[model samples]
Target: MQKTRLSASGAGLLALGLLAGLSAPAFAQEQAMDKLKSMRVSGIDPNLPLIPQTGKNADAIKENLKRVKMPAGFAIDLYAIVPDARHMAVAPSTNMLFVGTRKSSVWAVTNRNSGDAATEVKQFAPSLKFTQPNGVCWTKDGFLIVAEHNRILSFPAAEFFYEGADVAVSEVVPQGKLIPVEDESYNHGARVCRVGKDGMLYVALGQPFNVPPREKLKAFTEQGIGGIIRLDPFTGAKREVYASGIRNSVGIEFNPKNNDLWFTDNQTDGMGDEIPSGEINRATKKGQFFGYPYIQGKTRITEYGYDKDPVPANTTNPEVYTEAHAADLGLTFYTGDKFPAKYRGGIFSAQHGSWNRTTPIGARILFTSLKADGSADKTEVFADGWLDPKTRQYRGRPVDVANLPDGSILVSDDFAGAIYRITYTGI
Candidate 1:
């Protein structure tokens, strides 16, 4: 929809518009070079610091830890202090925690399994320069997969070789071509990746627009922008679109039971405080389209899905919706037995909070439960209080979450440049 009015708080919204820049252009002549030019855009540089970084002591973390609220028998503690931490993946075999960011490096959190905060944190592949390598996944075979702004890389036995510069990285998808150049823009370049049950790699490509311009729609559709694309992990061949019309999705997971896909989507902004809510969607089959630039949440984008053009008949609505502008980011299904019985098989999502609203919403962890039939039944706040309700100041912003092998959950906060572990000990 058209946003005719902009408020004072809209500055943050505008900043998001700028940071989210980085849409792919159509693959055509000079596209590769155009991709390079676009990558060097002033504000969206890989070297530029995206989040505030500072020293956080245990005393300070312990003080702020009092602010968090959770269910009985559940508690939260600082897990590790990871700078600019975003998406995370827990290695299946080694159980190492690999963190991704929108800057120049990736991180590994170690000594977490012991009864302590992480004793050590190190950068993965310190020798190689990374560019917004914000999407990460640990494969079933003890490998680490990373998706960058312009390419995808896989590191075999990443943990063992992470200490030295001799680490070998195999390029899964060559850089500068993941997103088309003709449609390239400035926003939404941080990708989230996962290996589905089918042994294919699925990566999220958020269309870089509040509402896509008409000229860009064709290219977005053709290049699989604003959708999830799957390819054979070994050959990077046999590519196909798994979902479409997603504005910008930063989190994705597969239900271990049915092997269906689930993702969290950030909704359109500047629509006031509560018009379009962020979403958690379930894709039961291939080629499903979750409406964007057309349908938003359960409501249609008034300006676009009318007149000659209309909302697609097959648009699938989100199974769950958070408060408007919650900026939901990463999510994982609770397959661990660490928590209470009720939490098993439920979905845990992180809401990155709102920037455009005068009254902020969602800088916390959320839970969505399913009925026996597997349809999403309800969504509720699981943990909160990161944002001070009194001063409206944020001490931290929850960006993404990864469930640990020990039954705890790792919550990443870019604002505070740290990660926190939440565990249940029983009252």
Candidate 2:
């Protein structure tokens, strides 16, 4: 069951913000609707629900799988089961998928044929001590980069195929420095990192917490310690800030058409279940601030009460907003011809659902069509039903999404510890 309520104050604040920019009422209405569309709510039940233990009966696993929802012509099939998996990456050239687990190890899953099951699954790196492998990316040179808690590890793709009891091709390229956590707030820094089209490695270092003070923010922004940072993969030369004022951006990707970078950011918690929705923003230029701690979606609601210090009026707003606490994660653009023509350049984002809201939201994948100018026109649910509103329980939690070589979309569910492949077959 789903409940709907209107926050007139929120709407009024949005309308006022729009009016300050545009005089036309029609345009303001459109902008207001856009803002509303981005607001999401989840975790209506404040009490922490018990997560079913793994290795339960098949019936129990099947019951938990109910969180996933798919369209009519598409079917969801399990591609692999990885226990404690959080983030993953795939190499199209080698037909291999590398999954990063929370257990400080990386696993490589390979399929002999595209249509067949994964013929082999093995741990590629075992000596690595990771609090959690939060991000993984494959370079064009067949090197797999894994983002550990405070370091980056690289391994050759051929190490999996080399039959040996002990293969040692893994190398530590960069040892990450922990962004100082000001307060006792959560500071899990490992998010998304990828090699950009400019031949530079970009990593998103999330803020220390939901909202920090101005001094902390200044330190993070000026030093390129928070938000996104660009570095040389070989020399580790740090350069400009990709984007700033971001809370917790767990996923990032590059648009294939323009090579522009984009990310999904989870907003501050405890602001009801719908005030500050998660966001999707494009890194169009260096030092682009998305207005965190000061404003959310153009509204000035500072969690740390630092609004007295003037923030720039032109801080970039998100291209698209998701429901609050939806926990939007990995994002990708569909460049394959596997789906219909409409999905050609659209964006697919995985919503990891919510942990703090009273009403549950997210737990699905969403599609948004990007206009020629790189702004989203409209967003809609491509997949859903991950949470049972009646029971206030979840079947699965989607964490990431990727497109395969054959144009199919693959969604990774971190909660159920499985990856689902969705293929479209028109009637």
Candidate 3:
């Protein structure tokens, strides 16, 4: 049963940061309502044009999908046309998906028929303006939390009421408090978040630099920069650093079996093509550090005098290492039964490919099989052909991977501005 105090008559009175199974006192609930009332949209026009769902642009995306190659029994098709799609959150109780963008908009996509494609796609909360709202997550109790470049907001009951322009909203982390204004950067600022099984919100904050100077390390660690932080979803209280020494992590997920936190960190640049490797790290407990500036994926960072500094004794290295400059971004653990047995409890990660490699690689999806102890056993490419081998051009760069209700998976491509659903047919 749902643990919220929401009643049939007072459903609209839902407040912000309402983590599931946590009960608030009467005064606390009233205070939340008061705060919710003050969170109003300002300075943004509500009648902004919605993205075109069906057009010549969408047909171009569909044409590109025909070139994408997966396993023999699997097929991929266009699911929706979302501009600047960065990350996605699939609603648990509603047939809707909230997609975030690096621009000023979040999109609401409706799959009313449970068909192969979305029927309606529109801007969510047209009345508000978002700044690089690239991170989105949904709670089991019906709240949609959007983590922007420098702020975080929560919408209560956003799944059911997103069709309207106005939705009840509150601030999970107010603007300028996510990070200092001076520390915000155009690069490495895309935040990603997930709700943990313990009813806390875990957010990854990327440090904005190729390699941060040693003088900034103390301040960054104190502020949870270049690390993952967990906080109380209700009222944004009890904020604490969960993990440290991460360079710039854009993908994070909690393992379903043991609830261990796993993430993908993009390593430092300008270190040649094949030196420091991008990392897939696992944090089994809080306060764990993953060796960022001193070491990246078992390679000591010599640039910016990082190698001169002494490494911490408690620093934990990455569990799995991918090729350098592969730009591994989003990942998810497959817990569904529709796929073959080999993929049941493994992980699917998207490598956005490289930017300035001598020869480009990794515009595809990769899978990692796990051992009984939850350690990574083997890693291999699961899908490719997104990058043309001869031309070295990317047809689509995959960003994030998500699961559909039917046990299939959805992959978001920002380059193609579309989401593709991949399903197994058992041939």
Scored by Cα lDDT, where does model 3 land?
Answer: 0.86
The lDDT-based order of candidates, best leading, equals 3, 1, 2
Per-residue CA lDDT of model 2 for 220-254, tens digit only, reads: 78655558887665445665677888877888999
Q: Give a tens-digit lDDT track for model 3, residues 109-218.
A: 88988889987788987666688999999766878999999988899888887766667888888878999999999989899999999989999999998888778999
**Candidate 2 segments exceeding 4 Å error:** 1-67, 158-173, 176-186
In order, the Cα lDDT scores of the candidates are 0.80, 0.70, 0.86
User: How many pairs in model 1 have backbone atoms within 3 A of each other, for residues 3 or more apart or on separate chains, i.e. clashes?
Assistant: 18
User: What TM-score does each of the candidates earn?
Assistant: 0.85, 0.80, 0.89
Tens digits of lDDT, candidate 1, 345-395: 999999988888999887999998888878899888999998999988888
Quote model 1's TM-score.
0.85
Clashes of each: 18, 17, 0
Best by TM-score: 3
What ranking emerges by TM-score with the best candidate at the front? 3, 1, 2
C-alpha positional error of residue 68 in candidate 3 after TM-score superposition, expressed in Å = 1.8
- Candidate of highest lDDT: 3
